[model samples]
Target: MANDDLIYKTATEISALFRKRKLSPVEYMAAVIARSEAAQKKINAFTFTHYDEAMDLAKQAEAKFMKRDGRVGVLEGLPIAVKDESWIAGKPTSYGSLTVGKGYVPDRTSPNNERILKAGAIVHARTATPEFSCASYTHSRLWGVTRNPWNRRYTPGGSSGGSGAALAAGMAPLATGSDIGGSIRIPAGASGVVGYKPPYGRNPDDPPFNLDPYCHTGPMARSIQDAILLQNVMCGPSPHDIASLRPKLRLPTEYKPIKGWKIAYSFDLGIYDVDAEVVANMKKALRVFKNLGATVEEVDLGWTRDAIDTGMRHLEHLFGTQLALTAKKHSKIMTTYARNFARKGAKSKASDFFKSMEGAVRMYDTFGPMLEKYDVFICPTNAAPAVKADFDENKDVVRINGKVSPLPKVLAWCMTTPFNTLSRCPVLAVPTGHASNDVPTSIQIIGRTYSDADVFRAGIAYETAIGGWYGSRKARPVL
Candidate 1:
C-alpha cells in the first residue's frame, strides 16, 4: 500500500494499534498533519492548525497507553478537528466571515467542545465554514472555496465543506460538524464520507438558545462506525440545553443487523425531480438493505415541491439572520452570496417568518405518524452529483435532467434538509457508489427521532456489504 493508503485507518482501528504499541498517536498525528498540510495548500480546508499542540496531546495519549491499564475514552488519541463556528476558548471563532477580523476570542467555550476534550479527544485544528454558515456551500471572501477531494473540480459540499474535505483527503479520521439544514449530510454525500446528524441536543450547545433549541452538534467520520463511536462520546443531556433528551441512554453495545427493520425509501420525497442516475443508485442501495433483511418499501413524505418552497421562503430567515448580525462592517469584502443572504434575512417580515415556521409545524405533525410504520427513512442524499468547482451556491440555477427545477440555489434537490426542518430526526449519509461521470454519490439512512445510533447501525450494515465508499481517485489539487 502507498503511504497515503496506510493513512486511512479509522479511529477505532487506530486506537487498537496505539494500545498495542504498533502505532503511536504521535505518528498518526504527524501523518494526518502532513496530509492536512499538503491538502490545505490546495483546498484551504482549515482556518487554523495546532501542529505543536497536536504533538503535545499525542505525547499525553502515548503516555496513557504506556501505563496500559484500560481502554481509553471513546475518542482516546484521535486527532479530532472542530468547525470554526463552534467556540473554542483561546482559539478565534470566525463564523467563516471576515467581519470579526480578530476582535473576539471566546473566554467561555461551547459545552460540545468541552465534552469532546473531557473524552480525551485532541482537537488540533479549526475547519472553515461558509460566512456565518449562511449559505450551504463553503465559499467566503475571507477563506475562499474549499475544494472537493475526489475531483477537486467539484465542491466537497458545504457549511461542513471543510470537515468533509479534510476527512475525504485523509486529513483526519473524524471531525465535529453542526447541521441545521443538511450542513452535515450534504458534505458527507458530496465527499463520500459518512456523516451523522443526531437528534437535536444529542450533543448540547452553549447557553442563550440552549434553553430549548433545534441545533445539534454531531460527528463526521470516514465510516459509519467511526461516526457512531464519536457521537457515543459526544451525546448526553446537558444542564444548559433544555431541549436535550432526558435520562441518557447507553449506546447499543451490539450493532448486529436488526432482523427486520422497516425502511421507507423515496427517490424524490414524492415530488422532487431527481436525476435519473440518483434514483438508480438509491434503488441499488435499498436493494442492499433488502439483502440485509430489511423490509424496504416506497413511501412519501406528503410534501410537494410547492409546500417545501412555501416553507423555505419563511424558514430561510433563521440562517439569514446571522449574516445581518455581521454584514455591515464586512459588506465591502463579503461574497455577494453572503451580502444578499444577510440583506434578505434582515428584510424578512415577521409575518413571513411565522408563516414558514407554521408550515414547518404542519409538516412535522404529519411526519410523526408515518414514522410509526417504519424504522428509518432512506433516500438519495442529494438531488444530484457533486457540483463543479465553479457552481455558485447563491445564484446558480440547477437543471435536473435538462428540466429547470424550481428548488432554490444550493438547497435544491436535497432530501436531508427536510428532516432538519421536520421531526428533528437524525440522518446519516453513507456513500453508495460512483457514477459514470466520475462524481461520487450517496444514500441517506435516517432513523426515528432520537434513534441516532440506529441510523449509523444501519449504515454500518450497508457499508460492510458494499466494502465502504472511498473514491478510486487519489488526493490531488482541484485548481
Candidate 2:
C-alpha cells in the first residue's frame, strides 16, 4: 500500500495487519509519527509530542505481535492521540491553560487514559484545547489555533478540536475527546470525522467533572468502527469513579442493519438558524437513510432557546465555576474567552443553577417520549459550517444563512448543547458533505437515553452506505 494509504488506514484494519504480520507496529507507528509531524506544521494540532517514547512502545507491541502470543491487547499497536485535558501520570495535564498548567504534573493517570494505555494504544502526542476547555473553538494562550485539515481558514471545532483535526489529517487512526457542551461533536462535525459521545456514565471520567452529568469522555476517529474500538477500551466501570456504570456494556464490532428503522430529523431543532448548505447536506444525508429502507420524517422538537440557556447555566454552575476560581488568581494569563466564561459563571446564582436542573427535566419530558417513537433523531451538528480558525468566542460574531449574531447568541448556531442538557442520550456525529469553502457539514445521530447500541447501529449502516470517509488518498485532506 502507498504511504498515504497506510496513513489513513483504520485502526481495525491496522490491528488485523499487525496480527497477520503483514505490517509491523513500529513501521506503522513511524509512518503515523511522520504524518503527525507534517500535519502539525499545517494545523498546529498537538500540545506535546512523544515520538521517541511512542516508538519505544511501538517496538514492544511489535515484539508482542512477533511472538504470536494471545496476550496482546486489542489496540496493541495503534497510535492514539490523547486530548491535553486528560491526565497521564507524571505528565502535564494542561487543560489548554498556561495559568494552572505551567509547571503542574499529575501523579495518577485519568481512568480513560489509564484504560487506553492498558489497551496497548501508543499515546504518540497530546492534542490541544481551548483554555480550561471553556470555549467552542480550540485556540488558547498555551497552544495556538488548531485549524481544519480540509480548510485551514476554518476551525476544526473544540474543545476536542485537536483530536478531530488529527484524525481528519491522518495524524492518528484514533484519538480521545471529552465533551461537556459539544466539545467532541463540534470538532467531529467541523473536521469531518466520526465522534461518539457515549451516555454520561458509559465511559469513566476523572473526579468532580465526572460527577457532572453534562460531561462525557468519548472517542474520535476517522471511522465509526474505529471510534467504537477506542470507546470499548475507554468505557466500563472504574473503581476510582463513582459515576462509572456497573455491568459494563461492550459494543459489538459489527451491528445489525438499520433497514425498516424510523428516523426523525430536524433542520434547526426549533431554535437554530441553520445555514443553507448545512440544510442541503442534511437533506442529502437523510436520503441515504431513506435509500437504506429507513423511513425518514421531520419532527418539531417544541424546543426553544430556553434549552440552550439552561445548558449554559448548568455549565456555568459546574465547569465555569472551576474556571472562575482559576481566574481569581490568574485572570491576566487566561484566554479572553475563558475569562469571559469565568465571569459569567461567577455571576451565576444558586437559584439559576436550580432553574437549570428544572429546565433539563422539562426538556427531557419532550425528548424522551420523542425517542420512544423514533429509532433515532438526526439534526445538523452546527448551524453554520464553522467559524474561523482563530475564532474568539468572546467577541466574534457567527453568521448562519446570512444572519449574523453576537457571541451571546452563538449557541443558537450550535445544536449540540441540548443533548448535553439531556446528558444521557448517546450522540454520534458523522459528516454529511463539505460546504463551498470545503469545511465539512455534519449531522448528529441521537439515540434514546443509554441506548448506545442504537446510535452505533445507525452510524455503521450510514457509514457503510457512504463507503466510509478518508479511505482513499483523494478523500483525505490535501494538507
Candidate 3:
C-alpha cells in the first residue's frame, strides 16, 4: 500500500491487515509518525511525542502477529493519539496550561490511558487541548493554537481539537477524547471525523470527574467502525471507578439496517442560531438517513436558552469551580478564557447550582419522552462551521447567520450542551459536508438514555449511506 494509504487507513482495516500479515505494524507506525510530524508543523496538534518508544512497541506487536499468538488484544497494532488531558504514569499530562502542568507527572495512569495501553495500542503522541480542558476551541498559552487541518484559519473545535485534527490529517487512525460539554463531538464535527459520547458510566473515568454525570471519556476516529473499535476497549466496569456500570456492554461490529427506523431531527434544537451552511449540510445528511429507509421528521424541542445556561451553570459549579481553585494560585499565568471561567465559577452559589439541577430535570422531562417516540434524534453538532483558530471567547465576537453574539451567547451556536444536560443520552457525531470555507459540518445521532447501541445503529447506517469519510487523498485534509 502507498504511504498515504497506510497513514490514513482505518483502525479496523489496519488491524485486519496486521492479523493477515499483509501489513507490518512497524511500517504503518513509521508512516503515521512521519505524517504526524509533518501535520504538526501546519496544524500544531501534538504537545509531545513518543516515537522511538512507539516504534519499539510496534515491533513487539509485529512479532506477536508473526508468532500467531493468541495474546493479541483487540487493538493490537493500531496507533492512537491520546488527548493530553488524560494521565499516563511517568508522562507529562499538560492540560494545555503552564501553571498546572509545568513539571507535573502523575504516578498512576488514568483509566482511559490504562485501558488503551492494555489493549495493545501504541500511543505515538499526546494531542493538545485548551487550558484545564475548559474551552470550545483549542488554544493555550502553553502550546499555542491547534488549527483545523482542513482550514488553518478556523479551529478544529475543542477541547479535543488536537485529537480530531490529528485523525483528519492522517496522523493517527484513532484517538481518545473526553467530553463534559461536547469536547469530542465539536472537534469531530469540525474536523470531519467520527466521535462517540457514550452515556455516562458506559466508559470508566478517573474520579471526581467520573462522579459528574455530564463528564464522558470516549473515542474519536476517521470512521464509525474505528470509533466503535476503540470505545469497546475503553468501556466496561473498572475497580478504579465506582461510577462505572456493572456488566459491560459490547457493541457489535455491524448492526441491523436502519430501514423503517424513525429518526427525528432538529435544525436549531429550538434555541441556537444555526448558520445557513450548517443547516444546509444537515438537510443533506438527513437525506442520507432517508435514503437508508429511515423516516426523518423535524421536531420542536420546546427548549429555550435556559438549556445552555443550565449546562454552563452546572459546569461552572463543578468543572469551572475546580479551575477557580487552580486560579487562586495560578491566575497570573492562565489564559483569559480559563481565568474568566474560573471567575464565573467562583461567583456561583449553592442556590445557582441547585437551580441548574432543577433546570436539567425540566429539560429532560421533554427530551426523555421524545426519545420514546423516535428511534434516534438528529441535530447539527455545532450550529456554525467553526470559530477562528485563535478565537478568544472573552473578547471575540461570534456572528452566526449574520447576528452578533457575546461570550456566553457564543455557546448558543453550539447545539451540544443541551444533550450534556440530559447526561444519560448517548450521542454520536458524524460528518455531513464542508462549508464554503472548507471547514466541515456534522450532525449528532442521539439515542435514548443508556441506549448506546441505538445511536451506533443510526451512525453506521448514515456513515454507510454516505460511503464513509476520508477514504482517499482528495477526501482528506490537504495538509
TM-score of each: 0.93, 0.98, 0.98
Q: Which residue pairs collide, candidate 1?
A: none
Best by lDDT: 3
| lDDT tens digits by residue: candidate 3, 294-390 | 8999999888878888998899999889999999999999999899989998998889899899999989888889878999999999989998999
User: What TM-score, to 2 decimals, does candidate 2 have?
Assistant: 0.98
Which whole-number lDDT from 0 to 100 does residue 430 have in model 3? 94
Clashes of each: 0, 0, 0
Worst 10 residues of 2 by lDDT: 405-414
Clashing pairs in 2: none
**Candidate 1 structure lDDT:** 0.76
Better of 2 and 3 by lDDT: 3
- Higher-lDDT candidate among 1 and 2? 2
Q: Residue 35: error of model 1 in Å?
A: 1.2
Candidate 2 has an lDDT of 0.89
